[model samples]
Target: MTDVEALRQQVAGLMPKVRQDLERLVRIPSISAAGYDAEPVRTSAEATAEILNDAGLAARVIDGEGGHPAVIGSISAPDGAPMVLLYAHHDVQPTGPEELWSTPPFEPTERDGRLFARGAADDKAGVMVHAAAIRAWDGRPPVGVSVFIEGEEEAGSEHLPDLLARYADHLRADAVILADSTNWRVGQPALTTSLRGLVGCTIEVRTLDHAVHSGMYGGPIPDALTALCRTLAALHDERGTVAVPGLKSEPSDPLDLQEDEFRAWAGVRPGVEMIGEGGLTERLWTKPAAYVLAIDAPRTKEAPGQLVPSVRATVGLRVAPGDSAADAVGALVDHLKASVPWGAELTVLDSFSGEPYRV
Candidate 1:
């Protein structure tokens, strides 16, 4: 048989084992977000290292400056051969509202030719794909292989630069396969050419030193929450394009998503009009602008009938490729300051920002 046929046969034979391995990994609640225990994160890293070891690479867990653990492994190739780096993350997002899930988020369930669980597709599957490729070659591929499974991608990858610096020599390779993106379709493979970088900040608007009764202060004085809302609403224009000046954008390659498919993928509610003016892909992939991630205002259930004294909100800015994250962040802060109503006291807190990258 030809090498292609032999490889296909090997992959076919490995499917059952791969499924079991994925199930075992999906069982771990390795949430690296705040408020979750760190033990599960470490345990998941250890398990990933063991998988790498089974794939015939010398694997071990390494801790970064942030204290989260990561798995690294390597198998050297013959002289003059190229080296390849495989990248994935093992940590998962917090399973929000367990009641919404058909099965327990930690328990893997198979139905309709799909596996349902947190991290199943997002990255645990990525780890398994790397392992399967290594096993297909009997743990000895013609080219060098290095595995880097990170543990804190869901948490903004806060310390990734430090981790990369610390392990610079070991992680270096001619090419890197970041197995964290989506395929074009179920049967189609795709390579992501570019990614937008992110910058964000939390702004606190303080209209009053303390809450005042709304009945007495309602008409002439605007509450801090209302002021914050108005400022946020001003971020986009009538056509829903971002109004922030000084932000940068570039021309993107033409690729269109049909509106029906987009609505299905985005879960947009019926009767809701799509925002922003431009080609859909251009607006999504090439734009730099504002997005409110979270607000720290009081919940409706817990809120009193008094005027809000202060409101804090986290605003995320997606920097276009070729734009500087720091400059984008400065423009965001400037826009928020310029848009504040009634000269309300504003304090902008800087959060982590990532530089935009192109491949």
Candidate 2:
């Protein structure tokens, strides 16, 4: 048999073992968000290192600045082979609202050939795929391999670029594979060439110092909720597009959803047509998407619907490749403050900001 066929057989033989390791890695709830367990994050990082070590790769834990530790591993190939750099993150997004999940999020369970877990689809699966492939070559392949498994990717990978620069000489290679992303859909292998960045802020409007009885002071008092609604409504124009200047440029690329595919993917019940014009890929990939993430105002549990003393909301703006994060946040704040309906006082607070990468 040819060398390629032999390599394929070796990989197929290790599939079961690789699946077990992947499930084990997924069981660790490595959430890097605040208020989550930090120990599990550390455990996941170490587990990744262990998997690399077992495969005969030089693996170790590296401390990160104010973030979960990173697992850095390396393995050399036989003489006269190419060197490839691989990257994957160990941290997972917080398993939100357990009620939404069919099974426990951290407990990796396989059904219908797909692993159901928090990090399974994200980077864990990618990690296990690489490990299995390397083990196919018995740790030493035809090409050199350097691996970087990070724990803070879900938290914005702020410290990763610095680490990469610091170890540039060690991690240098002809190609770098960032396995943290995937194709738009299953069964179609896609290389994500672009990613959208984000900027967000919280805006609060105040009308009264304390809650007032709506039955008594409804008409005279400037309602904070109404003011907030007006400001939010002004964010978009009659074209159903964002009114914030310099925020959305003309989209260049297209999105995945074609007309028929969009109707199915968006669950647009039968006769509904997709929103906005032009290519779906361009609309989602290159175009700007904006939304109101949350409102901090009192809910119906505590405050009566009648009382409109103060209102607050968090707005998120997804920027294109050329837009600036700081500029987007600033423009959003300015718009809200300038559009108050009842002359109510307004305050905008900037929150987390992530700049979009053109690559």
Candidate 3:
């Protein structure tokens, strides 16, 4: 057999162990969001380091300024080969409403050749990819490899700047591979070269100086909640596209994805129709999207009969490439102010921006 075939066999032979290690990682609930236990996040970092250590690298878990622990592993080049940096995250997103899950969120269950778990694919698999590649080479690769398994990526990577500054030399590489995107197909992997930035903010609408009986003031006076709902509704047009002007948009590269496939993947309901005006790939990749994440208001059970004085909502914008997040957020604030009905007062509680970048 040829050398290429031999390498393929080595990789295939290594799958069982890789799957085992991946299962080990999937079991750790490394949720980095506030109010969750921090110990699990730390445990995931240590587990990632251990996997890399077994793959013949010098690995360790290190903490950044007010950040969750990150795992770093390094293997030196034999002589003159280029250094490659592999990036992944050890932390997983919170498993929301566990009752909705078909199986336990932390338990790795195999069904029809696919593993079901919270972090099984998004990014515990990435960590194992690095480990398996090194093991395939018998712990000695022709090129240098440096691995960075982030611990708080799902929580917006809040402290990434500190980690990058502190570990500049160790992470410097000729090329970087962040294994945090979708594969082109089941067996065909994709390389993400461009990414949209983010803008998030909380806005408050105050329509009443004081709470008044909704029944008594029903006809003439307006409530803050109603005004807030109107403002949020104006974020999209009749076509369901983002109505905010001045946000950058570019067509995505055409792909072989069908609407049925997208609906299936997204778990769209039987009667729900897809919105937005673009090819599926364009809508998914390049075009801008606005989402209302949450609204902070009194619960229905404990709600008083009085009209709400003020209501606050947290919204997010996915900024397209070539648009600065600062500019997009400014436009968003302007749009909210314009959309508020009955001249309700609009106040931007806080805002955050992340500049869009392309490789």
Model 3, 26: alpha-carbon shift in Å? 1.3
What is the Cα-based lDDT of residue 303 in candidate 2? Answer: 74
Candidate 1 at 59: error in angstroms? 1.1
Q: For candidate 1, report its TM-score.
A: 0.95
Tell me which residue pairs clash in candidate 3.
none
Q: What residue pairs are clashing in model 2?
A: 253-282, 254-281, 254-282, 255-280, 255-281, 255-282
The worst-scoring run of ten residues by lDDT in candidate 2 lies at 248-257
Candidates arranged by lDDT, highest first: 3, 1, 2
lDDT tens per residue, model 3, 114-202? 99999999889988988998899988988999989999998988999999989999999999988887887777778788888899889
Candidate 3 wrongly placed segments (more than 4 Å): none
Each model's TM-score?
Answer: 0.95, 0.86, 0.95
Tens digits of per-residue lDDT, candidate 1, 1-359, equal: 34998999999999998898888888999999988999999999999998889878899999977667999999996799889999999999999999999999999998788899999999999999999999999899989998899999998887788889989999999999999988765656778878888998999999999999999988888899999998898788887888888888988877746778878878999999988767777787888766899999989899898999999999988899989988888888888899989989889865668888889
Q: Residue 42 deviation, candidate 1, in Å?
A: 1.8
Tens digit of per-residue lDDT, candidate 2, span 235-297: 777665667776755556544446777567668888754554446776676766677888877
Descending-TM-score candidate ranking: 3, 1, 2
For each candidate in the order shown, give its overall lDDT on alpha carbons. Answer: 0.89, 0.80, 0.91
Which regions of candidate 1 deviate over 4 angstroms? none
Instruction: Give Cα distance to truth, residue 134, candidate 1, Å.
Output: 1.2
